[model samples]
Target: MEIWPAIDLRHGKPVRLRQGDYNQKTVFGDDPVEFAKRWQAAGAKRLHLVDLDAAKGDDPTANREAVARIVAETGLPCQMGGGVRDEAAIESLLGLGLNRLVVGSAALKQPDWFASMCDAYPKQLAAGIDARDGMVATDGWLETSSTPAIELAQDLRGRTENIAAIIYTDIARDGMMSGPNFEGLAQMAAATDIPLVASGGVTTYDDVRKLVQMQMPAAIVGRSIYDGVMQLEEVIEIAGDK
Candidate 1:
């Protein structure tokens, strides 16, 4: 299993929001690139980045630049999502050297377009399924949909060849540093044949261990590492990252 350290960028700064609430965010530092480098040095094999501003329908220019710098400096394979809804946005981010682009709202709202994108960019697109109580949330978790997350994952399973992974995030646990929703993740894993990248509420080595036990291909850890509730190196070691 791979452990990905997360960096949520808001206006070019590294920050994290609790329960996907923008009003409840904690800015970690001014330079997100430095944070990326820190994670890389700490033995992170890949990085998970989110553009908070973009996810909320704001301009992502600043965060885009920050992402570019991180890619140029750290040289770690990075996967980013937030406001990536169109071909142009996808091209722009891929041009920045991102290894994978995650699409959430777009995938839920327009499955055909998402499928076309997957066909166009094989192994470069990941479905970002952010959910609360098994229901899918869109537009950066500000709006919840009636669609069940497991159902969406099952639908996306048809395009598993093109889709790189499914990044399943439990919105309620995100940034809370409590623990990952193992039950929810397990349900998603069972519903889809595509690779599962667990996200949200990953706080301790035990959490990572359980995820590993669940056979998750990857797990994204955010607030816990930033808040020191968990150490990146320890979790990386637990994940057996080489």
Candidate 2:
């Protein structure tokens, strides 16, 4: 499985939030571009970037400059999410050479707009199925929807052919240092034919190995790396080993 070290930006800095809470945050560094470089040097193949501020209804432009710098400076293929709602926002970010752009709430709330975007940018789109207790979470994970996460993925399969990946994030597990929701992951993987990217609660080498065994296309790790629980290189090696 491809291992993506995450760089979640909040207030123009790299920080990890507990259970997707902005108030309970741990700032890793002030310069996110430098952090990108550090991940690159440590053998990151691709980066998962997110704008926490933007995700929370803040100005979408807040982290654009930082994101552009990270992509340009490290020259790493990045998949970014958060606050990308319209065609204009999607166009602007794709112009930054982002490998993939993820749409979370928009997929469930504005299916038509999301479908149009998928049609416009084939193979460049992904749907983020961030959930809390199996219900879809929206608006930076602050609100939970009655829709089952698996049902949402199944619905999206019929909505657009443009989505190249399905990023399933277990909000409760996120930044909790517990472990990924393997059962939930397995269910989603079974529900969707799109390539899957697992996120949240990944804590150790075993987590990487388990994801590989589960046949995930890619996995995103954030808090563990920042907290010194595991190094990026070590996980890369674990994932890459034959």
Candidate 3:
């Protein structure tokens, strides 16, 4: 399994939000590019970059530039999401050389557009299914849709010629150091054939080990690494080769 260290950008700074709440945020750094380099220096093979400001709005140009610079400088394969709602933005981000582009609300609000993007981008697109209380959450985890996350994943399983991955994030456990939602992940994995990437509440090396034992493709760890709960080097050693 690949360990994806997260770098969420808000106003060009690295920060993390609790349960996807913008009000309950913690700034991790002033320079996201430097932070990405640190993660690379610590043995990060893949990086997870998010634009918090973009998730809530339509424009993410600043964070997009920051992400482009990080990818250019560190040479780490990065997957980015948030504020990706249109074809132009998607095309722009992909033009930046991102390994994968994660789409959330667009998948819910505009299935046709989502399918078109998947078809257009092939293995360069991933569906970000962020859930709360068994229901799929959209609009940065602020709105809970009627569709269940597992069902959504099942519906989108083979919609794309090469769907890069299905990134499942448990909003309740995110940024809380509580541990990942393994049961939910197992169910989602069982529901879809696409590669699954677990996100949220990954607080320790054992958490990563659990995901690897389950044969997950990858896991995203944010707060744990930023807060010193888990060392990046140790987590990478545990994950081994992708």
Displacement of residue 214 (Cα, Å) in model 2 is 0.8
Candidate 3 least-lDDT 10 residues: 154-163
For model 1, the local distance difference test gives 0.91
* Model 2 CA deviation exceeding 4 Å by range: none
lDDT (10s digit) by residue, model 1, range 143-186:
99999999888787664569889999998899888898999988
Q: What TM-score goes with each of the models?
A: 0.98, 0.97, 0.97
**Candidate 3, residue 57: how far the Cα is off, in Å:** 1.1
Ranking by lDDT: 1, 2, 3
| Candidate with best TM-score | 1
- Better structure of 2 and 3 per lDDT: 2
- Point out the worst 10-residue segment of candidate 2 by lDDT: 233-242
Model 3 spans with C-alpha error above 4 angstroms: none
* CA lDDT of every candidate: 0.91, 0.90, 0.89
106-211 per-residue lDDT for model 3 (tens digits): 9877777788888888888899999998799999888999999988877776455567888899999999999999999999998888899999999987898899
Q: Which candidate do you rate higher for TM-score, 2 or 3?
A: 2
Q: Write the per-residue lDDT of candidate 2 for residues 1-242, one digit (tens) a residue.
A: 78888999987899889999988999887999988999899989799999887799998888989999998888988999998888888989999989999899999898778888888889899999899999999999989999999998888889888788988999989999999999999999998898999999999999999998888888999999988999999998988821
